[model samples]
Target: MATICISTVLNFRLRKPRGFCCSLSSHDKMKNNNKRETPELLKIAVSGITELLRIFSSSKDQRLDTVTYTQKDQPLVSGIEDIVDILQSDYENAYFLTGNFTSSIYAEDCSFEDPTIKFRGKDLYARNLKLLVPFFDCPSLSLQQIQKVVSSDKSCVLATWKLRTYLKLPWRPLISIEGNTVYDLDDDFKIARHAESWNVSALEAVGQIFTPGT
Candidate 1:
């Protein structure tokens, strides 16, 4: 007499409670979905950046590509074109986080709590953060590479910005190209006065924040 195990039969359903089918492997899933690679704009950008930032050591006369901002003695992303794009581009429903805000800004070191970061800002706060990214721009040795200030790190300024409109008359808003909230480019000054909450304490904490436009 052959007996089928009831537990085994029931467990099959448990494996896929959603019934969405998990049998397909990650690679297989992409393949089945007909995933194809888009033109790698990053590589092209890297090459052009490398050309722009051929020299390093940080000097007023030095031909640098990237620039940095030091408001309270902290290293901020400031403005690396590619990096800006990186921060602006939308991710696959992701999260961008770091253990220490100090380290994240200064060291370029980050520990993304979420596997991916959808830079697209669905919230006002997120939009403001995107504007802040440019404030960190510094002269790069090569494209995204950081260029030390000839001697001391005092080449850029650290300022604050706002995501929404606040001007009494009219506020020129930046529209994200990809329809993502993160990539907004304003023709007029992007900084919103009241919306900005920058303070000496915040600047001091960040250390070496910059206010270039200031």
Candidate 2:
């Protein structure tokens, strides 16, 4: 298990940005308020990886009850080209930041792994993304390259991306990470595994959380 030092960081809170517009209607404002209850939510958000690891282990059997879609609504693709298109579109729209990617493209038990943690089940993966949404301020993911590759009998979709996000810590640390993800497809073309390789070490990535923003 990887350990991160965050004892001093958890007391942080998120404040609305200066000159940020809030023009939501009454109903919309109520809904947004219901979605996030502050202070408590802030506590959960800033604990960061420790909280994520706990949730990853504890949520193994939980289903993604947040999403509902019938067969007609599923973005089921028959080939790598279609898969690539959907993925690119999702990244373009920053769906990954919002935890609303097209889940139909991934296997029900698809495995997800990065330098910090690893887990099985796409439902769990989605839940993890949803958990991190509270701390992702002005997040951006730039897709540099995406292509299909085959090596002997195995094939996968590899995508390189640059990610920059201002974590809602007290000092507002800016995390900039460049990484590539390998999506291994199953027989039916659904993603069986999603593995990420970062340009920095696990320690370095964690250290970014403590570095104060400029």
Candidate 3:
């Protein structure tokens, strides 16, 4: 949840200039250009190292502190059928990406978790979603499938989705994640836990932030 602002390292495949090393003046010009870029490249490298250090030094619980949670009016979900309908409608519009989710269907202390972080409190989750708003460029969440699963002992809603977004970085890195969420309903039929599983490993997902656009 740290708002990372590190620039991705660029790999340039420079083609050899025609008649390279034909003149001493040309070689000197190239050296000057390299010198001019060295500082900028160093800055980028430093920023990237700092960001990673911050991520690793902080505990998962500490990361939640970075998000700002604002209290909002809480409402109740009528029933299981109603919750399903609301979710279907909200997901179609990518409510999560826009921070426009209906907070009523979730308990005040509903737990949320994806590959990166886990925490309790619906307000915190909502605020965290809002944090991504500034950095998101053409974000999309496609709901592949959704269903209510009921069993003798457990009942929940399982929804599969694909999320794609371009982070507003200089490199225009793309974050593409295919995942599913399990919304566990409490006895009162309110969502108590929203757990997600991604197709890629956690490290791979993190790596996506540093990769150039595909």
Candidate 4:
């Protein structure tokens, strides 16, 4: 992100009557005033703006990059190997997640629900992920189990996983949560609905926060 600086200065001097102004000094004062004020005003305005922008830009960058987590080197689970691979690769990369997986793996009218929120449609899901980007850094999801069940015309996958993350908060830097997702797949194997269940509740998550690596 870049910050734009705009500095403007306007100086106006009202003309005085010749009788009120000193005759000997009036001409010299006028000449010197124009020469001095213009450059000084510009310099003052420009420097002030530059310094303010420098401070603002640095602060903004720090806030955006504050949250940092470690990626766990865990192997994928067995059953849904292909989806697990995609999760490890594309979904893990925060930058690529919204663009790649949301459109391909999920149906447009997909319903998603977790402990915190429930929403329908891929656009809302993408928006929720975008909101998380600033607060999530280097987050990793490890797959523990994957089971596939097929009925007459429909199929579903149950995936159990653990998410380990470092939340860049002064009070709680480390957070670990275990959860499972059940995916209802359409005839083409695209995800029609996704739901999640976590071992911890929202208040429990707040209580479980600890220091990183502890």
Q: Which candidate should be chosen as best, given lDDT against the real structure? A: 2
As a TM-score, model 3 comes out at 0.65
What local lDDT score does residue 92 receive in model 2, on the 0 to 100 scale? 87
Candidate 2 lDDT over residue span 1-214, tens digit each: 2122231112111111111112223224323332332344433444565555545645663444454432236776878888898889877866656776888898999976543344588876666565556667788888988877655555677667777887776777877876566678877988888865555543455578778988
Candidate number with greatest TM-score: 2
Write model 3 residue lDDT over 32-123, tens digit each, in one string: 33232224444455445534544543444475456543344454466677678768877997875776777778889997643223458887
Any runs in candidate 3 off by more than 4 Å, and if so which? Answer: 1-77
Ranking by TM-score: 2, 3, 4, 1
lDDT of 4 by residue, 65-135 (tens): 23222344443333344554544454355322123343566677987643333347776555434334444
Candidate 2 ranges beyond 4 A from true positions: 1-72
Evaluated at residue 117, the lDDT of candidate 2 is: 40
What value of lDDT does candidate 4 attain over all alpha carbons? 0.45
- RMSD of candidates 1 onward, in order: 24.8, 14.8, 17.7, 26.8
Error of 1 at 185 (Å): 27
Residue 128 in model 2: lDDT: 57
